[model samples]
Target chain A: MSNATNLDGAITLITGAGRGIGFGIAEVLSERGSVIAISDLDADAAGTASDAINSTGGQAAAFQGDTTSQDSMDALAAAVLQEFGHIDILVCNAGVIGAPGYQDRTEHTEADWDATFGVNVKGLVHTTNSVTPHMCERNTGRVVNIASQAGRKPRGARIALGSVQSPYTVSKAAVIQWTHLLAVELAPHNITVNAVCPGVLWTPMWETIAENQKANNPELSELTSREIFDLSINERMPMGREQTPRDIGKAVAFLASDDASEITGQALNVNGGAVMN
Target chain B: MPESSLGQLAGKVALVTGGARGIGLGIATVLVERGATVALCDLAQTACDKAVSDLGAAGHSVLGTVADVTSRDSMESAVANVNTTLGGIDILVANAGVWASEGYENRPEYNDADWDITHSVNVRGVVNATEAVIPYMKEHKRGKIVNIASHGGRKPRGTATGRTLGMPYSVSKAGVIQWTHLLAVELAPFNINVNAVCPGELWTSMIEGIFTNRQNLVGGGSGGSVRNEYDEFMQTTVPLGRGQTPRDIGKAVAFLASDDAAEITGQALNVNGGARMN
Candidate 1:
């Protein structure tokens, strides 16, 4: 078996565990034997993830909490603590890409920025802040934040050319910086904080963006929309290709595990060579 | 293009340097399954022949060649052979590399010969292979280069010996990053993508080399081989509590080589299992 396999019996909590990268992480972690706590904005979505895990004979529980709300974060953390006793791992994976057409700093409204920051940045902060105290008490813990490559390099074309926009990019950048900051602070507590920056992945979010572009940009056909989405990264890395949610999940699992103890305060790139750090 | 979308890389040609074993071999295995004709080149002729034959037995359009990535002439010949046989070169995985450093206290003094050899294979080797194939890509106006680096290159020297004890390996890897960046910008006009894949520690010949080096340095004692301590050290540090496998890196390399990553350019993808966030 691979060293990364068989993650059984570890108690782990994941924010935004309902779907996408967060859900993917939950799935892999469970497969590797981590007892999971799935937290999401939608209770039903979180239940679905927990149910999927249960169906596979894995131990999991679902918690519904508004990612942008402190009360929600606290309640979820409390529930996990009550049921699981202690959380060995925390994944602040909840995030948003913001509303479409919210391009350029000038066009971006304060409300839009606030909403994006609330979900992407503040949501992460709330989740981490809630779990870290317990973790610090234990003197051993792992926090994996889901960031975006947009945080590192501001490739305007990545947003302007496709579905993502300023709020998502800005919020992700904040998450990355915050990760570094937290890493430094938490390292002394023996708690490692790191972010997983993903490149483009074919997900429901991507489909929604593609559909919106097709419907909104009436001048372009559906086929053109697909091509436009395909042309995003400029394909600079000749050997391999784009980031996948599972790819990010695997990296997160690795980080959350004991194998990465010496690795503190580092931003790991899981973008399939799309963004090299 | 996620979740092993069937035939994503159908009808493509790929060349993986140092593809005889380890992460490179894993990448070649995946690409072949995805319907790409794979060409694996290694400095060791016996290893290359064995890999090619074994992969060929698996019903893949796979070929093996003996070539040193450190030498431009060797790389050129290998690329030329692949081009003639495979019809054209579309994907280049500059994955051939050697780890010469074990850290400071492990070796005490830096070995210049080890450092030079490491750079030749890791840095100059990647440059040589990419440079030799770029003209073909320029002719076709499209290509991809994935340079394999390490997560060790990303962090500071943790232990005295810096894990493997050689400064050149880390320095060369740093060079790999810049080289990837430079190539990415220059090849943009040619529609060629150049990126680096910084893999975390995996169980490969490279790691084995580190183990052997550590064992020799420490000699026979109650501690036994240095690999054990190194493995324990990795276990404690990696968030995931595990080391990466070759296939883990292979799947990532496969994604970067596929059309799904068309928009990605001049970037480094860390497959280190949360060891590095950026």
Candidate 2:
């Protein structure tokens, strides 16, 4: 598809950009002429991703930052601002789906809840707090949060991944609500905040989920992990297809561009007919 | 406005149905503010002209035309006129809708007239507007359509304290949402994005009328005003602790109409202050 966003000369910061949806967003933004700053917990993976982009004639820099830590995000922000001179967009893509034990609320641990919220909710706050000041100083910026369709509706037994009672689902719900709250608060700075809700992406997160489901459910012992994943996607997704990281990247890139200036405080669902609302 | 600061709808032509007042006028105002030439279509020529004059007084490029949304011929004629005068209809805000006053008490025998009026204006009206504009949009291979729906459509039918949006209105709005989804898929190949905006508890004239009717129905000897009832409902229901304004709805519509929402389709965006998350 032709790129409609004019992100040329823009500086973008993406958390968890080492792989999955974050890396996809970084690659798309780089192709659109953005100087990408890849911040991930894995320093080596972040560096490799940044090098790959730079080798493709794109401007990119890698920085290691733990999204769950405010101080780490602050340092990452300073490094990115110093290198790029100004930050134009911030994509909050770092998130965590708690362990298999966290799927059932009755059996879930407090630690599981904390881990999920720390990365999904608090991490969002840290990154937004760190970079929004610079955006407010310049009176312009874009914040695209990668939320999940699970936030919109509870996933019952229809999906084999995250349960409706899981902390991951609760955390994503918080992310969507936070998108609304922050959009209202930051609209005056001309900084648009929006969330992209992706449906059933076959990422490393899904691989772990499939493994856990197969291990726990005895009826699914005959099925391979890939087959189990495909079965879930086919049953749950109305479009009968799984979403790609690039699909999410395209949605984020559009929201980050100047074309979406009037769009703030909205959650755009990139799910393939999974959750209409 | 500076060239850079101009809205994304600059140089675009838009047609908003039922634009004489309420949410329709709000959508039209925002479109005009964003530099689009807007045509306000309503059933009454006098009201349409007054709305146009009101917007024109603010130095906006606006026009008023008479077209009954329930009548396909009227809508086609109105759209044809807008295409002739405004160059072409690049954006369509199908805001023409009507609310039935019948409550759940009359659910069994809800007058045929009441139900027909609600569906005719809300459901068929949206279809008429979309059908009228689709040809122009398909020929151009570019368009944006925003349908004004309500939170009542998303929620189940039940009257709790302050929640009394009539069952017919709720059903009609639900149809609007479903229609928006189906049309979005069909129109995507044409590059036209179709979406619905569901507003919650806005203090519009229509809603004020509903509150007054409710007060008359249940007020009895109580000395409470309808405004007080509305305030009470907002406090108990809305998480944001307040109701949304027409401007909030307008801004959301403007965003969906803009190129910023180019990839967004088959979606119903709720701008109801977190009252309905889904």
Candidate 3:
């Protein structure tokens, strides 16, 4: 609403906030003046993160909640309301890769699909649904869903051989479409819903992918993390370097802020220059 | 594409459809000013010749050709002559388009011929031109294609009849929207970048004609006047409280067609005055 960058007094919630992309988002959101509530399945890790935020003079609390459970989702919302009064931004960043080697079509199982979707797709919905009513009443809110470039551009050496087929891709694609639908539905209420499609960053997901590739082919030596990320935009990723989680965090913060009020139903790519659209 | 022109487009050649006027002419004018051998193509030979001669007289290497965008043979010949005369094609601006039924007076019984012509010139013509030059681009391993769409393709035009004269125009523009993505994906392998620009209302001759024709066909209705209707739409709908200019659209097209947009393929960018952020 204002040109100022101060996000002071904003109430923000991030799912799967223990580490990796979720933690990256939390750190940036807190730095920009938001009082954050970090939700994670691992209560201990979340506590440590909350403590870190507190030590840095940012208001934050940890909620040990399983995203797959409706009871946990409602409880997280209740706790946040009791602590912060209202929620202004919802970051649907929780996700899981399931077990290793699950991407191999021949080795995949229904359990892998259900597990990935339960935490990635259903989890996002549960968290977002928790914040909608409060945001609707306020007539001001921002919802940022973190998707992957893989969801839009299905390209990988293993994908060609049906080796990388997995529920992760399906779940992420669902997230992107879900963002699009919510954007229109919430337009009348002055709420903006957007998704960010980030390519391979130096995150835990990249490590998982690299390890999976090595496990699938013992003869194939693991490439450097930079090498893996460099391949995101056919190595022409315009930012001219591998992506750091900070790049994704900066974009998430920008979208969640008032500066992006006019932007909605759009999927902004923060993949260094990969996936420009 | 050719040794990175160092921003010349200098040694390269370019062509823009609908180049006789409006946004197309704006882009053609910029390209020529930048030192690229440019060509102007339009449905009317007289108009095309006039534009070419005018630009040529100003010390620019420019050509004018009468061609139907929807015609494959015409596009092939136009592209061939540019190649023969300038040696190669570097940039292609597919900016020609027509938008009738602006005020939705002919909602139910709108001219079928008008719809057919819009689709032919706006959508199919783009495909024909792109497909024609893609082969040579693949061989050369680089190219840039800019397709002009509209913000109307994304939002609905609300009117009392609820017709809004949008179905045909929006449908055709939507096709261009999807075509940008399809072409981007297909040409990325060949080092070619394909992008689309969705312009908001602009002060162009074509827009003036639409307003004048709307007033001639239908009275101001409940509104005060045609000018009043235009003012209300611009001030109320757009956040910036203003409209775009041909030069504004030109700057956006130039960005997408340049190396700055090298990694920006499959993108449908809005050059609206903050009307539609996506």
Candidate 4:
């Protein structure tokens, strides 16, 4: 599809851009003429993804930043502003599914809740706090948070995934609510904050989810991991298809664009295209 | 400045009932921007003509039809007009609505006529519009239907008087959501997905009336006093600290009509600046 909106010389900082949906967002924005600041916890992975973009004739610089640390994000934000001079967009895409042993928990522990929120929720605060002051100073910025469909809707009862992934889901719900509060606070600064809730996508995250589901669910024990993923997609997604990382990228790109400036504190679900029309 | 790239409804036809003004017109505007040939269905011929010509002057493919959602025959004729003039309808936004502001009190003890008018226009109108479009949509084997509901439908709003929102209007809107869910299931086989867009706060006549009534119930300066009250309400209750615009609701309805929301149906999506997240 031909893109009518162009970012041109926009500068965007995307957390967790080393792989998966974050990398997908980086690629799309870069295609639209954005100079990317790719920050990830894994330094080598970040460098590899940045190289991939630069090799494709896009401008991207990789930086290592641990989202779990406020000081790390603060330092990373300063380094990025120093490197790029101005930041136009920030994608809070770094997320953790659960606490370390959450997948095995029958009942979630307090540590599980704390660990999950520390990364998924507080990580966003660190990044936005470090960067939004500059945005307020300049009076221009966009913040696109990557939430999930699970945040907006409850998973069906009796689903093993629901119990195992409660922390991730709750944190995403927090992300959406936070998006609203920040949008309200930052609107005076001309900064629009929004969240994109993605549907089922084939990613490393899904790989783990599918593996666990196939092992845990009696109905899917015999099937391959891919089949299990496809089954979930068929059941959940009305279009009976899986979303690509680029599908999410398109949504993030739009939310970060100038045309959507009026849209703030909203969550746009990037699922199987609604085809409602 | 670059134009919006959110045009997923290109080459389609959209009909927005009650499209003469307010939220309906707002929805028509976005659909036209998305490259859809639009037809406005309204109760007033003059308003409809004015809306049509205004949009036409801006280089949009648009027309107007006179229809009353309370009258099935009137709606069917409007849908037929769209079919004959625009070829087919791929999208329908059932947006005609009325608040319980006529000859009634604002409290729970609102009079009988208000109840009749509320259900007649808000509830029956949505059903009429939806029923009129379904057959045509079924023939095409695909359609998107969006009903314009309100945040009042999901929860009971408050006034400084400690009185609740207009009960009849709120109840009718809730009924609209119920119908949307039911229609989604009934129409899914025909490739028709139905959803309700529950708008939060907007500065329309409907909202103006609400403010006027609130002032009547509890004095907020003059009966016309609303600016300060609106700001206070937004800052206090809404997380986004702002009222939604008609265009904001329009964008949401357009998205629901587009391929991006194909997975959504039988759902009441809130577009109220996070006023109500669930």
Candidate 5:
């Protein structure tokens, strides 16, 4: 059994903790008594999110960092470590959806693929590199990478877009595989690494996806984004319900807890059963 | 309705096939603990009665049924019994399964019997249970069907069972996973959610039996106890370096059965302490 079981009073660092799922994770973790270090590319968003947590009676600090830049991540890591004394958990939730999957397009633009990969895949690596050293120094840590159900053999899952969001989906796939590789690498250090594949949360990313889907599909042009989202939910989601950010946050919190110390190199799906692979 | 979850399956009638012991019992116990009136359906009346008694002693609502998952008629009657006795079949945990290790020596040496039994019990059994409940669920317009799968169905483990090579059991589990997908899609309009839970490296009697047999046939006087063999495999393969409890599998089944997973369908969730992740 590991001595670190709970997230109570642990110092944590989260990438892209500005809003949506990232903020959702931060809030849940903070409620669990962890001091949060919120990082985002947008300084205002990061600060506002941190402040929101603080106002909610959770300890938090804000730092501006772009996950695509290793140097920037490294600096942000240093600042967070200095401010928080140590980083017991690192949540690499910063991600991009790339281009909205259009029904008519066979593939996405190169820039879309690169941008999606840059943030979703490589961004995770950069952030992991930034925080793992401090964790390695202490010989204990937890890493939860925010992945997507789309990344896990989701080709046949219509709710996740069969041919759409390829770049984003593929990049998330890479992130999951990378989580395994990193978990193996960090397991010896007592550092558990995992991924959380959220199902269908109506976050900003999903809004974009719904908008693009409706825009690209002639039949859906008359429908609203929320309506399109609902249609996908009703037709594809067996539960016929939308997933909440809190659902994903709860999963991340579990993986980060001591109870999940034995759970590593795994991707936990928080989707409402849309994609189960 | 989707707001309820985890510990809130109260009053829901849950039927667990092969629920006398092992993983099936594990799922039944959890569902019972969560306040569902559980019907334990197994092949032997004695085993089912004992299981039901043990659960009943704990002050939970539970019943027993002697039914074979491989037989559609038996399953249909069992489902009907559950419906009449417990009011309705709200959730069905298709936990009955068979693992064929009698064949596959080096590289999947498939035996005719192994293939037949595995498919008959693991794949077709799940389908039978699901089909038996579909009419009732469709009539009720609310249901959750969770099929038991294995990590072997998704990918080969790097060690242990992986060394046994891909065989009938793996293929049969693969079928269950696929069928879950199809059923999830087909049953969506009926407000029924279908999913699969793939457990990894649990040390159940079935697993203990596998290890003992494997040691006898493969190790040839390697002098390791079954538990020792299981521990060694967990150490080498599982990143978490641990074996999962049936309770762990139960938690997953309960989650998928609850409103918490209302949007989740056709998913194969792995509950094996990171032993297998694909």
Candidate 6:
């Protein structure tokens, strides 16, 4: 109700902003008058998101950066700094849930585990490490990590036909822990670090999961993938409603705003009454 | 005090346990500032009355009630009195809590009374206050519950005075945090959002007393007062380079109590200036 989170004239860099929660965050923050830099692994998607914001009279630019590559992050930070002067906010929203692994951890391939951690855990580190020095030098910054509810609670075969193995959950848990460590480390520099745990957003990631579930089980072939996803949401989400990308984005905006100056080192759950931790 | 920028809590009735002083009073102040009528419940009538008079002089709608949070009967009675005077409670800030002074080195000698008192006020106190407000909130089908916990519950950290305050205080806070989670799950059906705010080392009388005890325990041979030791500890331990104020904790409580946090439940939000992150 209180739209006092004034981001006027601030420069915000959001990773994975081509779509989903990251794009939602970029849109809302831009509406608050912040200059946005939309970075994603997909160059065309980033360009389109940036173009859409720019067409709406909001200042925005697109950059292609892979979170898994430290060099790419550094380059992205340097380019953004060169263009916008300084970055006041960084939202680490890039993450990956590996292909459904074997039911047991022992049967899971090393590549599967590495890929999950590579994008979720190590990618977050690369982006934070690249941008924090500039923020520390300026003595002000805000970092919002988009973690998931699975990070706080074990998914444990909750999806009707879908299976979530250890790699994704463990990586998200690591992101939460890393958010804590970075929050403490950056506090002295006046940079606030926090994590947002979103629950059951109908993003491309979930669509992929739903498609995989429909394909993996022939018993559920009659039901569409979207129907299966809805069933999972109805069963797990206590609010009896699906969470939107904007819901998570609003939460990220609140944490990054000046109104939340006292809030740091906290992982706020933006779920629909699921995984209350 | 600064004017409340957002009247998000206007027309809401708030009841705060241990509202005589410290964090509870701070939370009550914020709620009242946000245009909510507040009821101050504390162990003693004198302290509650004094606090009410002080806050009343500021042109706020506030009442004082004598209630021991450790006793369910007293809490229930206090809630009844508040409902009769201020209307049904829309928000409950369970801030009543206590700490143990025994050192970890002397854990063997620590009596059962120490542990009992700590758990009674910190853990059971939250339960008593929450239970009293549930029926009123259930009738309305809407409410917000903010439990005051400590950073000690989230993770291990040195005391403000750089002394070990033992495990009872941390363990009790952990119980409070866990209780918040379980209550959030159970009460979700009633549309009551239950959350906890874990304050870091705030400069309160309770913490000042701990600092003094630590100074005395070290025999004051370091040639520094308790305040100085606390300042140094804050400088080194707290990444923010300062201890939190009561208002800091109060603002967090106000946030969770507002409709802005409707979707947030079963959360342990740390307001310790990055002392401990969970």
Q: Give the winner by DockQ: 3 or 4.
A: 4
Docking class of 1: incorrect
Candidate 2 regions with alpha-carbon error over 4 angstroms: A1-14, A17-39, A42-63, A68-91, A96-144, A150-194, A199-267, A271-275, B1-6, B101-111, B157-159, B162-165, B220-225, B228-232
Residue-level lDDT of model 5, residues B216-257, one tens digit each, is 666833377878988888887777677888777777777678
- Candidate 6, pairs of clashing residues: none
**lDDT of each residue in B46-152, candidate 2, tens digit only:** 88888988888887768899999999999999999998988899889998887773453323334666678889999999999999999989998889999998877
Better of 3 and 5 by TM-score: 5
Candidate 4 wrongly placed segments (more than 4 Å): A1-9, A28-35, A51-59, A99-115, A152-156, A161-163, A180-190, A257-263, A271-277, B1-8, B104-109, B156-161, B181-193, B222-242, B260-269, B273-278
Model 6 per-residue lDDT at B28: 87
Q: Candidate 3 — which residues are off by over 4 angstroms? A: A1-6, A99-107, A153-164, A222-240, B1-149, B152-266, B269-278
RMSD of 1: 8.2
What TM-score does each prediction get for chain A alone? 0.89, 0.94, 0.89, 0.94, 0.93, 0.93
TM-score for candidate 3, residues paired by index = 0.59
Give the alpha carbon lDDT tens digit for every residue of A1-277 in model 5: 1111236788889999999999998887887678999999999999999999999788999999999999999999999878978899899999987744443454577877888889998899899888898888899999999998878884553543344577887898899999989988887788988898887878888788887777677788899989988888777665568888777776776678755555678887776666656
RMSD of model 2, in Å? 7.6
lDDT by residue (A149-185, candidate 2, tens digit) is: 8888754454543342377778998999999889777
Better of 4 and 5 by TM-score: 4
Which residue pairs clash within candidate 2? Answer: none
lDDT of 1 by residue, B1-278 (tens): 22222464677899999999889888888778767889999888888888888887877768899998878998999999999998999999999888764453356446877788788888889989998999999999888888887765665635565344656777788788788877887886777877777888787777776666666676533374556755775667665456777767766676667664554566666666456645
Better of 1 and 6 by lDDT: 6
Alpha carbon lDDT of residue B137, candidate 6?
94
The digit string of per-residue lDDT tens for model 4 on B202-266 reads 88878777776776677775334587777677767776567878887877777678765555666
Give a tens-digit lDDT track for model 6, residues A169-188: 78999999998888888888
Output the lDDT of residue B42, model 3. 92
Tell me the tens digit of each residue's lDDT in model 3 across A61-142: 9988888888899999999899889999898888877655553433556776888889888988888777888899998888
